[model samples]
Target chain A: MKVKAFLLGVLALAGVFVGFDLQNSHGTSFAAKKAANYDESVTLPMAKYPETGKHIKDAIAAGHSAVCTIDRGGAADRRKESLKGYPTKPGYDRDEFPMAMCKEGGKGADIRYITPADNRGAGSYIGNHVENYPDGTKVLISVK
Target chain B: MNKLLISYSQLIITNTDEEHSSFQWSDEDVKRGYSVQRGAVAIEAINNDESEIEVIVGSYLPSEKATVTYSLPFPVRADSIIVTSPGAVTLPFSVPKGTYQLHVEAIPLQQPTDDGLFPVRYQLYFDTNGSK
Candidate 1:
């Protein structure tokens, strides 16, 4: 009877360890799955050329798309702040890519146009950034 | 014979539309303190020429698909032996928040001789907040 009890206790410990490993593996797989489908939603407004904003408009009409349009208030600020600490994965540089956060009060929503080449895992990065935001915090992302 | 030369040019960014408080581009600024709060950028150009020179300013965000470009015609007078501008021509533009590489091409519209192109690359950091 003593021997059986000891073996049962050891088996229980092993089962706990297996459960923890499975949980960890599930978390990693979830992140990878999210990374694979990074496109969230189109938010960037139509891009306007300095001289002629027509090209961008026409392109939009023809199906050219903008990725994300973020609000310029506290929500936008939080998003920007979160992105600041976002770790640069392998083969990525924060400087090489242009990332503007416009704060013009009355000038509509701030738009960020990102191409596939520019945003390899932009969705995942953004998802990771907003992971800690309180419920109802708007986190918008779009891909082309 | 006159050579169109760009002696010195610096990219300045300001938070206010008034352009009173501005910061100059520095290596440290690019690495650590690069960010724009109000989305205003000023390109100060100094031309070394005896006469007026026409320059084209072209810029684009490396991560963005669209490019913003415009041209400027600068006038400079020559005095004594050295050619200098009466004052620096300030080109101001309202830019959205983002990291960008500004390329300025100063080509003499009137090139009697072969005065090679003077181009300068300035790294731009524009942020509404200090996120960049």
Candidate 2:
């Protein structure tokens, strides 16, 4: 009778352990950049260009569709906040691609328009800088 | 040659009959500690066929003394604000529910030589309280 009681107790303990593991089991939870519940409603930083500025007017008028109007109001709110650190080795700058421009043939069409980090030292922007939106942000580029 | 300016912003508004009930946005209003001013041009769209929309841009100095305004032609809007200083400027303003054009302007305004511009980037809030 004692042996049977011991066996039942062991089974019950095993079942509890299994249940706990099941509750925590979700696929690929080890990934570094998964969006959290807090990341749901985020405001992205966006830059706007005015036609009055010389280079901007020239760029937009030159048919370079990548250049568009800037909304400084959007940029002001997004100035220099901590970003989710990506997996990176020390001393190496983070590899990033600006969210593709919508005007022309999607992305990969024009390389000249892209401002490289090497030429413009990482974040040293000479003129108006548009904070690149992270992947998966709903974007709206329009003409009014 | 272009100049670098910081600590300022270009207020873009889509005004109707009253001119106050419109959506306005800028970058210089928020980048605090760094000088925020007009920088480079982003884009320009012109309507040769007919008068479409008008864009008006002006520089808003945060303080009471230094006056600055770079108003654009009617209908030509701004998309970006150039950072005149090495850092950032922040502005906070509200927009009414309406379709509008946008742009930014920035110019680096400080060297080791000049006095630093405004402090603290402007935080955007609806004009329900009134302008500061």
Candidate 3:
């Protein structure tokens, strides 16, 4: 009887451990989504020569600019943000964002990556919310 | 540990100085005229920075048929004028041409602080091109 009770207790402990492991796995995806959140930062590539034409850093900045224009609502359907050829341009580069992120269940707001044909860029629907702003709102930003 | 923190600070400052700059607009200013049938106008403010720019567009409505008022944020000079819709639009001290007037202006930006970020806003007003 003592041995049987010990086995039953061990099984219950194993079940709890498995449940904890599953919960942790789900938490990792949420953390990844948060990590991908948009924050203002300039990107530059490592380069040895300043005289080099369009170094990697300059190229990276330009690439992000193209990717930031596709955040318009109702227009970003079936679109994606390309991260290919990121450090170098004039060469073929391809990227695609998860389609699930653009769906209704996704957290995509009024701004995001859109179809490549429509300028192949990102966009925002800021003008749609102009009604909520004050009469004289201004903003200054420094990017690096 | 103290030395490591100091080294990190040095790296951040050096990186920031080498890699950052403020965004300037493609054009110094944009100008548009308003007239009859033109109730509003829209203008785009370019954000050269990596972040989004929160800006506002608006103008004071005219009170008289031949009178015109300036926008809150005065422009340095007038440039190319496009008809937003249809309204009487005249430059500062210039003659008003039609029954109504329209003008598009960029207000100050509400910058985002450590506390929170502000959304961009725009306002549109119409005028009968009248004098007060």
Candidate 4:
């Protein structure tokens, strides 16, 4: 209605997107800031860090797609399951494709040995970014 | 400060010594573009942004300057040219069979755009002309 529009205009004038409360399927209200800034999907730059990049490609090719799923919780459990059989090496870290945080990850995920610099750095870069996104999100796994 | 880069692709190049020989990978010659009627396999790899790339000739350990580097121990037969990037540009070059290291330098040469894809430029260090 025109009245609602006027109220929104007044709120926006006072502060950007203020008082913009919207309900979701769960019946919880979301702040206007979050409502306006939701990332539908994320892209994991496989080639951004080529060492970890190659491992991701090879792991997917080896049959692990959950690597594309974002983890909502239980990352420690997933890591334990996916890395159970792969022992750590002196110069290498056991890298899992469907990383621990991904919903599709854990237990039976493809594991590869890669350098720590590659494994840790790329993981943190993406982990830091996606931590802002909610759990159970599907991310686009891409190379180059 | 650390530099910002977009992509780091692991490229594979295959080379068959001859018609009836097993493939032994490594080194080669050429600078740009791909030849349809070619002797070596036309190879491709992924890069995120169309920033600038640095192609070096010779078999050396990976360089620290490169944003990302990998080894392609497959056979390569580039007696002519190569196609790189997101099909933006082509260059001519050549390499044969042997384990070789490839370095990808993805420094932004221009301002990035909204949608993320962009054009690319390159710099070549040394020549692998008749390089093995």
State what share of the real interface contacts each candidate retains.
Answer: 0.00, 0.01, 0.00, 0.00
Looking at candidate 1, what TM-score does chain B attain?
0.27
Q: Which scores higher on lDDT, 2 or 4?
A: 4
Clash totals, every prediction: 12, 79, 37, 31
| Tens digit per residue, CA lDDT, model 3, A1-144 | 999999999999998897678658878644443354422222211121121112222433443221222222321222222222222122111122221112221122222222211211111111211212332222111122
**Candidate 1, residue B77: how far the Cα is off, in Å:** 34
TM-score winner among the candidates? 4
**Two-chain complex of model 1, DockQ on C-alpha atoms against the true structure:** 0.02
In model 2 chain A, which range of ten residues has the least summed lDDT?
A37-46
Q: What are the RMSDs of all candidates, in order?
A: 20.0, 17.3, 19.7, 16.1
Chain B structural similarity (TM-score) per candidate: 0.27, 0.20, 0.24, 0.37
Summarize candidate 3's per-residue lDDT along B1-132 as a digit string, tens digits: 001000000001011112122111111212221111122222332111111211222234433431222332222122222221000111112212322233333232355222112222222232332211
lDDT (Cα atoms) of all candidates against the true structure? 0.30, 0.26, 0.23, 0.43
Question: What is the C-alpha lDDT profile of model 1 across A1-144, one tens digit per residue?
Answer: 999999999999998898677768878655443444332332322221111123223434554333222232233233233234333333222211112221121122222333312221232233224323433333333322
Worst 10 residues of 4 chain B by lDDT: B1-10
**Candidate 2, A24-129: lDDT as tens digits:** 5743332211323111121212232222222323433555443223333333222211112222232222211221212222232222222222212222332123
Ranking by lDDT: 4, 1, 2, 3
User: TM-scores, in order shown?
Assistant: 0.18, 0.20, 0.21, 0.37
